[model samples]
Target: MNRKFWSIGLLAAVMLISAGCGQKPGAAPDNTPEQVTPAPGGQTGQGNEDPTSGAGGASTGNEVTKPETKTESIKSYYTDPDVMELVEGTANISYKEDQDKYEAAYQTLQKSDNPDMIPLWEKIEMKSLKFDNGTITIDVHVPDEANLGAGGEAFAIDAIKKTFFQFDEVKSIQLLVDGQQAESLMGHVDLEYPMTR
Candidate 1:
């Protein structure tokens, strides 16, 4: 009988030690990576806890954390025969360089749309962009100038100006056609002078 009691007591002690070893003091068991949830407010969570809440307590609404935003502003143009206005939009150009930024901006303009707005650079090819001091010169190849209908030249020019001028580094823009400084584009806007931001 003494041997039986001793064996039972030893078994109980071992079970207790194993249970205690499974969990640390004041800490929860580690969760598997697959069980972890993402953080609040669209941010990624690091662990199995609510990311918006503090470590010690529930989160206050005011203490909510926000994910870092990666975006750049591009100025888009909309023309109204009665009035002209500036329309601003955001683009994912944070990873782009200066030339890439211009290309991205132009591509955005190409894709951007508004019921009252006319798209610029439609069917126009962007050959290259050159930066010198504060001046930005763009060489373009227009397959057809007749595509720019009535008052389209002004709107196109405005769109180019607003888009490139969004960057402080560009103080002026000089348009080039087929690698030469044409006197005018589509016989509407003069290309002899560089447009200032």
Candidate 2:
């Protein structure tokens, strides 16, 4: 029994020495250590957290607010495959608070769900959109590869106008190519600036 107790005391002294060696110079020799926790990224850290703060870290007031998102019904227009006229298609758009609603609606116009409908806007990329009072100005980038004729050009413009005019706030629309007003969108029909609803 005496040899067993001496052996246990030696083991306990070695453990105490090992634990004390790891502690900081001025740190108090704690009989009962405060619960040490695993920090973020699976890192083990000393339990030196402020009692006033929330469990994980700082207070909830410092937490970043998430951006609100909403899903809305969007009305988009496509060109008829046969007549090349405007065909309305309704879709649901989900967007964050800071995102542009008009851009979402405009993107929906680039795709058609109906088999008979054609997506004319797919030929051109919308660079940007600006609104003034009630007028919507659209800037587009038309690649040289797009071989759109006069009829296609007219129907494309018609689709854009029809799609935007669905909104009550839009009174008129002006089209721009590469941020400049051109005599024609594709050297076809004359572009009527600020086409009114």
Candidate 3:
């Protein structure tokens, strides 16, 4: 009624000067402005990471994992080809014993002490020895007055070709002095040729 108290004191002084120019209570509060959550890859932890990756700025904490490959097996037991074919078929040639090599080559040509070859090998006699292929025929038994000269028949053919070529499959010798084939058994070592040493 006094113009309605001067229009309610000019609308309460324009709402106290628009609430004193807005906010004030330890301020920065403008209704909706606290959403500043953008520091990953939008990258702002201030510098030095993507200069083509020295990998130090972006990862906020735990992730390093890696280990898995395995494989291994090459095998042995002395090259087991079924135990090397049973030690190469029991080390070849197994004659199950008893071959004192032609009775030690007829007791080394009957103990030769050469008394003109002791009555020509006291009636020389071996008769059948046989080895073949790698040679060893022997069959001696020569009689007819056991002739012995030319160094007692080259010491009974170099003591039966050095005692059956000391066997390893007898590599040579063939003298058949009595069963034939003779060009010299007392003139110079050559029982129809086959000695090989």
Candidate 4:
């Protein structure tokens, strides 16, 4: 009886070791790269051939490409005397570069409208825009300071600030009048320092 038990135990251990060594019937070997599904419109992974490629598996080079562009709809502010507050108007702008976007914003601010809003940018010309370290510096050519009204000056600054600050990248603004920094715009808000959003 003891000899029979020992033989059965040894046979069971051998069967278990052999079972661990071999793969199941249909399993594939490991370390294989995963198959990637092709992107729509006949685009495939880099260095991979597109199955839908024309004769001889050669690319037709007629794939539709999307334009690289950045666009934003910004609001320009104007003052309403009835409410004694700033009113906003929207302008859609598309640009390939950041400078173009800034120019578009300035142009939108200069547009004229009726009693609901005041256009303070009529006499002001945007000279340049500089962005550095989350701050934007805008240089403008202003007509004679003496001719600028106090109310207009304040509304102009507010409109400019509201326009640029619409972008999340802009944290503060430094205003320059004709390449020189002034103490204030018509004795209203100080332009000597940068204004935060």
Candidate 5:
């Protein structure tokens, strides 16, 4: 939509940062296959080339695969590097005592040359951020008369999720508008009031 509207999304991003106090981030993308493919016929491909075994194997449906072991990784709420640049470079933002590392990181991030990020970065209104055990929360505010736009809410959440997921400390995120959950920030996406990462 317009700058004023997108500003809201930027503010939300800042609020997310504020919530987090001093944590690293989250884990990496899930790589362990969540779904397994079954063979054509009733057979196994564990160690043989039996035709009856099909290609891979048969569905025993007896074993239960466990989730991947937890690894030391960072989680982020923001994905767009450009958006992160806005959050990092906005001189309006203030930090808690321990959030300095993230601030520094943002400083470097501001110098990132990813061109795709330019537009999104310019439209946001970054505020303050905090990092706790892992979750990073930023506090933000949009001009009362802004017009965020369709899908603005989703865009905002996706940005945060992508950004914080980069670290390992963050696990979840929450969004607040002027301090409360509301309907779509614009008209396309749902904030779901207090979104989680």
Candidate 6:
């Protein structure tokens, strides 16, 4: 999938800035291991690892360039089947220098290193996802095979929100079915468009 992305440094810098905003001015950014920001008000994202592993930046064309990779530390958020709450895990995604980091991060959220957590987006499919000026527009299509019941819908949304919001560069999200706006992704919850952090 072709995706646009802000530099990993930019994403981290945004996260650092936003993380500091919730605290006193000049305060340090929060990296609490077990931090959990409730849903609907998910102002914080799950990432805590320093995004300092970036190497080469975005490239263009089919020009043969140096073989370099960008390794970004990501926060993986999954739903706990037993507790019904989000379980957090740290993951590292390495992609081609010209590849989109957001795509790697999104894929990381699909499953967890911890087996106890359930992948929130295992069955759902995203047609397209784009990020611009702090907003992420996600065009999704859920097939009947997913069977994401009412409760499952809530968990999926929460997990997705928290997973992306962990990046301070993302200020809001606009969810769409196919390519148009909708009240809900699965006719379960009242999905408010342009959901803010």
List per-prediction Cα lDDT, in the order shown.
0.67, 0.76, 0.51, 0.73, 0.46, 0.72
Whole-model lDDT, candidate 1? 0.67
- lDDT, model 2, position 78: 74
Model 5 residue 140 distance off true place after TM-score fit, in angstroms: 1.2
| Worst 10-residue lDDT window, candidate 1 | 57-66
lDDT of 2 at 169: 89
TM-score of each: 0.54, 0.61, 0.20, 0.59, 0.39, 0.61
Which run of 10 residues does model 5 get worst, by summed lDDT? 85-94
TM value for model 1: 0.54
Q: Which segments of candidate 6 are over 4 A away from where they belong? A: 1-67, 96-99
Give the range of the ten consecutive residues with the poorest summed lDDT in model 3: 83-92
- Once fitted onto the true fold, the runs of candidate 5 whose alpha carbons sit more than 4 angstroms away are 1-98, 103-115, 144-148, 192-197
How far out, in Å, is residue 133 in model 3? 5.3
Q: Write the per-residue lDDT of candidate 4 for residues 1-197, one digit (tens) a residue.
A: 99999999999999998897665633644554453334665445544565666865546665445447888877887666643566788777787778778887888877755656666676677788888888888887776843346666777788888888888898999998778888876666666468887
Whole-structure CA lDDT of model 3 = 0.51
lDDT for position 152 in model 2:
79
Point out where model 1 deviates above 4 Å. 1-70, 79-94, 113-115
Write the residue-wise lDDT of candidate 1 on 45-86 in tens digits.
Answer: 653245556544344344434434346765666444333543
lDDT of 6 at 45: 47
- What stretches of model 2 exceed 4 Å from their correct place? 1-67, 97-99
Clashes of 6: 2
**How many Å off is the CA of 132 in candidate 3?**
4.0
Residues 61-161 of candidate 3 have per-residue lDDT tens digits of: 33232233322221111111221210100111223222434544455445333332232355667776666578767667666566665556665565556
Candidate 2 local lDDT, 1-197, one digit each (tens): 99999999999999999888878644645564443445784333543354544655544344334557888897777767775576777888877742377788788878777887778787688998887788888899888765478887787778788878888888998889899888788788788887888
lDDT of 1 at 145: 51
